[model samples]
Target: MSNLSQLLKESWVLVEERHDDVAAHFYARMFLTDPGLRQLFPVHLDTQRRCLVEALVTAAASIDDPERFTEYVQGLGRAHRKFHVQPSQFAAFHGALLEALRTVGGDRWTIEYDQAWADALGLLTSNMITGLEQDADPAFWHAEVLAHERRGADIAVLTCQPLQHPLRYQAGQYVSVEVPRYQPRLWRTYSIANAPRPDDTVEFHVRAVGAGWVSSALVRRVRPGDLLRIAAPMGTMVLDRESPRDIVCLAGGVGFAPIKALVDELTRFNRSRWVHVYLGARHRDELYDLDELLRLAATYPWLNVVPCCTDDPSWTGEHGEVSEVLARYGPWHEHDFFVSGSAPMVRASLRTLAELEIPADRIRYDSFGDI
Candidate 1:
């Protein structure tokens, strides 16, 4: 291993057990150093702390692989841009992080360990700065909500029109949305729910999760003519139309957003390749877009839609988790798989597909955090 990787791993091992405390210290020191920076984040620091710990651990573990580590850091940097992260902020964050590590390490810290951490942070932050510089699109787009349809009590489908310039994105990419009501500056990423439209319009499926500030505002407070700011599209879940392989899409709950967009893209070209979709929800009532799926399936003979319910006993439709339901359909060996939903669902689906011998390269997914 390189000196940078070895040092990071060794140092992280000492701090791993007290990661939460370290993260807490890092933020505390950060705000104390620059009090104004505190306003940039949410009031609750628990989730942010967890994210920082996870990121540090992941970076340390992956540091041996230069290409993968660089890609990961670049994506991390791009995601941070949606929050209006500035290049000038990197140094303060780096210093605070190093201080946290030293505070946690106590006598365990040495000059060598400090140098390694500084080097590692320099690499990560430099790449992040490069990522920020690479983006040519506007920081945010102004979109007017054209219509909002409540699919269920907790789900809303928003149709929006960009007010200034067209928002360019692939079939299955997501955009970070900022709603005015919830925590003013907080922005959340939601996958685009349809293929690119001729009118440059976009759709998003927002499901209100418990204590989800932006989602709750989008689904409960957003109305027609309401203006919202959207960051440039992010994510690489888009379909590879060049591939001749058939597709198997596994979607759970609101994870259907990007999967639907991919399927819609395929149907538009009347692609002869067969596409199978396994959409699941906890209750039949939660399968809010069944009609839309059914209509698309009918319109495209090559596409098959299977709806599954995990907890609804009264429903006569296929009953089981989407991954379990997928086992009934044989031979996914030749097909590419797209899995999305809550993190548990995605992890489960990936494990199942791996067991079925589907190559990892052929699977595409967008992690939706804990949703």
Candidate 2:
């Protein structure tokens, strides 16, 4: 790591545990500095605060990897466009961030640390500005919902068509979605559940979390014909077509979205590579898309689908955490792995991959934090 990256990471350790306080301070200072800026965020700042802190931590940790850092920050910058961020507002944000850091750092704060962070933020903001200005795509697209189906009480499958332009995206990428009718300014991210289709429609699988503003609105309230806003897609979990290795995909609950998309894409040309998909949920009822996946498996001899249930004793298939069951099936050290689901599930699966001595480069997942 560069001296600046080292310093930033070291300083971050001091405040990482108290990130909630840091977020509160940062936003308080920013809004206090420019009261009108408060209008730019959602009314409930709980999830937003966590997202801000996670973004900062991710950016700080990535500084040592130039390629990763550039791609992430540029995407972040472009993503921020949906918020209608103004260039003039960056100065206030910068000041507020530094103040939050200094306050949380307490006695450990030093001139060298401050200078390192200043330099880092300068680089970060400059690239973000570059990303914001160079992008020609619109900040967001308007899509009309074409279909909506509830698989269970909380899970919903929805499809939509972009009204003005093609919603071009890779098979495994995700996009932020906004329900203008129910939660206008509050946007949530969801993986596009299918490969790019000929008709320019996209699919999303959403499960409502308790009191989750956007998700509950999507599952319980959204219907066919509703107009929604779709932001530019951003993620790096897409297939590496040139890699000749076999693949392993682990999906838990609705995390199946991107995994399904990848499998859908693979079906078009894959004839040699063996693809294994492990779909896990708490109960048999929650294995919402198993029948469809099984049909795909039957149609494609190279594809294999395994359904796992953690809590269902009556489940006839695998019975354990998906990651644990995955451990029994491999010979996977040579395979490329794609993992998705709740944070705990992803973490456990990653741990399993690590224990199996999987190379870091051979595994990919979206760790951008809760949608």
Candidate 3:
């Protein structure tokens, strides 16, 4: 029997050779045939095409055990439900994906070759559908920009409102963000700053990265009343309320976005649970919601807030990167630790926590891939 891994590797070769280029052509075909789908994507076709290609590449490369891969694909399918993506929509994506495949398959593009590709996509999309059903459609999301305040030199908080009776999402969960100017419906995952329920608006605290398309557009151009495109909120960086352990939340810069929401949820029940938050920034001005955090710290005698600054010329507080500050103060054990931040921040803190012999199972993190 041929190994599924070998078959997938072969599929990847065909996919890799011209995945990007094929994706472009496929979307061109899609737009012509289904202008409706075109409306779903950004004005820039190349960019949208890349995201679809990138999503699939990431999906393909993630396959290790076929059983697990099927499960993951199902999860993606379920996740896309909020997009209101139909079975019909998959046809267009499938055509584009396969057309890209044929071009890359070159001499190996035979009958059996075509069949294998078709079977693979069928399995993948089918699993996606199953996953979607399992999660169920909580409710479709409607996007509204509620407030836009320039918090720092380049960072801003843009609060968004969800549809009435919106689907429930956890803290640290992010949605695919779509801005009109960029093409291909770019996916920038922003943590849900507000907890689920009661309030209908999901907030994202965005920081401009100079070259960042979404963040810059949000800080400089986006207005409170303006409407923007967004996908359904979904992510695993959430607090499992059922898990009744003490929680430690650490954030670096905008990583505070998710952690803040999480703390709110923790406070609702574990009013007496030890919830310690260590938030850091380059300067005091860079701190988002400093007053709010301190207030939480004061109110919950068990919850303490430690704000640190690493780069101010007049530096005081816990002076250093957030991770360094964390290891020094925490020999914290038997607690759930959540860290969300820039790649380096998350990586360094994970190392520090491990070196301190914090159990690997207790730590959770949110990290970005590529840019």
The TM-scores of all predictions, comma-separated, are 0.90, 0.97, 0.75
Total clashing residue pairs per candidate? 0, 0, 5
Which structure among the candidates has the greatest lDDT?
Answer: 2
Is 1 or 3 the stronger prediction by TM-score?
1
Model 2: per-residue lDDT, tens digit, 169-287?
Answer: 99999999999999989988899999999999999999997778899999999999999999989999999999999999999999999999999999998988999999999999999
Better of 1 and 2 by lDDT: 2
Deviation of model 1 at 135, angstroms: 1.7
lDDT of 3 by residue, 1-371 (tens): 24444565676776576777777777777677677886565455554565566567656655555775775587577657645677777777776667767776777776666666677777777777677677655524557788888887788888887655564677677766665553235556677787776767777888887566777777788887776666656566777776767788889888898899888777777754688888988898988789988888888788888889988978667888888888787568768899988878898889989888889778878865322
| C-alpha lDDT values of all predictions | 0.86, 0.90, 0.73
User: What is the number of residue pairs that collide in model 1?
Assistant: 0
Clashing residue pairs in candidate 2 are none
Q: Ranking under lDDT, best-scoring first?
A: 2, 1, 3
lDDT of 2 at 234: 95
